[model samples]
Target: MSSTLKVGILGYGYATATFHAPLINAVPGLKLVAISSSNATKVHADWPQLQVCSTPEELIARTDIDLVVIPTPNETHHALAVKALTAGKHVVVDKPFTLDTAEAHDLIAHADAAQKLLSVFHNRRWVADFLTVQKLLASGQLGRITHFESHFDRFRPEVRQRWREGAGLGSGLWYDLGPHLLDQAICLFGMPQTIYVDRVLQRDGALADDWFHAVLGYGELRMILHASMLVAHESPRFIIHGTKGSYTKEGIDPQEDALKAGVRPDAKDWGVDETMGRLDVMRGTWMQHSQVANERGDYTRYYAAIRDAILHGAPNPVPATEALQVMQLLEAGMLSAREGRLIRLHH
Candidate 1:
């Protein structure tokens, strides 16, 4: 109710430490007043002013908090978000919004009935490389994009024992990395007609799938989304062949790595990175052109949108309907992977 939105964070793990905490601190009209974490010592060490509670229930019960950001695990998103919305707090859930689409719908309905804002943190939508791709596509530099390929290959051969890689609900590269790839694709190309998926557990003693290759059918355009753990090396981060030209780039965005290294969001060159793609066009024979420096990634925009929506009555930037569409794409991808067929999406 005050000028600043009082935010109570649920869980203080990787997402909270890397994305939410730093960006929330950087935003002007938000206060990180409380947090819920079992590891009280670690919480205090990182954020001394934050009031650490033992449970999410305790944090949500506080009348002073207006927003609850759930950076919990992939599986718990639905239940925690539902609880937060029912308790009358606007909610911002970290992505892979829910393990299933039905849960997302339920949460949306609850939030709508409560007249509260509900958003999923699809932050990669603002990544420098993705923005660059958007710019090229809009400028028609790629002509008619017939084929677009995105690779998120990594070199970790050993299986991580964490829940993300272990055998459980909401595990595997598909659920973990699928949202980013799927959301970006949906943002650019809208819903694909069909998707052909090939999923595998390539690593030794791997409990869940660590590799995936999904081909999305975008009418005349054929887009391939791929990820693997056994890859000792990585291909170009992006490769697109359009009618007029082709663009290729070969490095991960530096923002995530920077955040992992404890870099503040306010630092110079914070989200600026040198991982831009080169465009080769057909002028007479072949003309190669280097892309300009990437636009700075502004993750704070996500929370800023949330603030304006809650305070100023603007529309939620990442609409619940779009999040539902991403969920639909995820479910379709899973079905295609399991059945070895192209899953068709009905509008």
Candidate 2:
């Protein structure tokens, strides 16, 4: 059963094209059997060997498919995942697990009942910069974290026609980038005490939100998640501070760009951030500043973990429950933004 984990993807959009397909094909035990896509030409061009189905129904129902990956629009995740899980196939839903926390809970219950593995594609947790921070925080080098900031900003002047930019529950910068930032926060610090958000359509004539700034409060420690389309000079990926020192990291993870450029995930020195982070730590009584060496951020680690969980029963890399917490934080942000008030998370 080593090579019997045939995986079927539920969409051929950017997420599937750039991330899921490439990463699935890269892993050893996972085989790309079929894909759900309307664009046969583009799908064929991307993978001539793989079978392309017109709809997700055809792909998820295949007897040979052991795993089903849904990288479709955020709104359709719950429905597709339910169908796949009920079909007795392991399910992988992309981030922002579902449009709402209720939908996420239902999916989790369905997956648990089906006894099939359910996971989310929370790939940002594998970033090299984040890994470094994890090491620092775990080592107690950053004593009593006071503030942490994570940004996923970009400069998109013209809001191209896309489902994410359209008017919907899962559309907007908050839904798009919020999951990534929040997942990272939850990984380090569990649920926050309060959530505050400021969401607006900053871009001229933009339909949905083009920018968002959220604050996750944990007593004295506050985590900031910010993203925008109008940022010409993108901010650092992470800005972290504690009682000991501050770590300001610049540059996004190279894996996504490398995938878009047709570079293999296992290429020479993959996931290595060329531009390292500036580390300021208290040495004795004074603070010393230096460049911290970055750990290689390999996204394939996620797929590998999935394979192990399916075949060898290893723990899931991004379990459904962890993704659920991210969903809860997202909903809290929405409530905060809608009411123009700070939403306190009891747990």
lDDT of 2 by residue, 103-165 (tens): 999999999999999999999888788898898788887688998998888889898899999
In Å, residue 181's CA in model 2 sits off its true spot by 0.1
Candidate 1 per-residue lDDT, tens place, 282-344, comes to: 777877676756766878889988988898898898987789988888888888888888888
Q: Which pairs of residues collide in candidate 2?
A: none
Taking all chains together, each candidate's TM-score versus the true structure is: 0.97, 0.98
| TM-score top scorer | 2
> Ten consecutive residues with minimal summed lDDT in candidate 2?
1-10
In candidate 2, how many Å is residue 317 off? 1.0
- Model 1 spans with C-alpha error above 4 angstroms: 284-286
Local distance difference test, each candidate: 0.88, 0.90
Task: State the lDDT at 97 in candidate 2.
Answer: 94
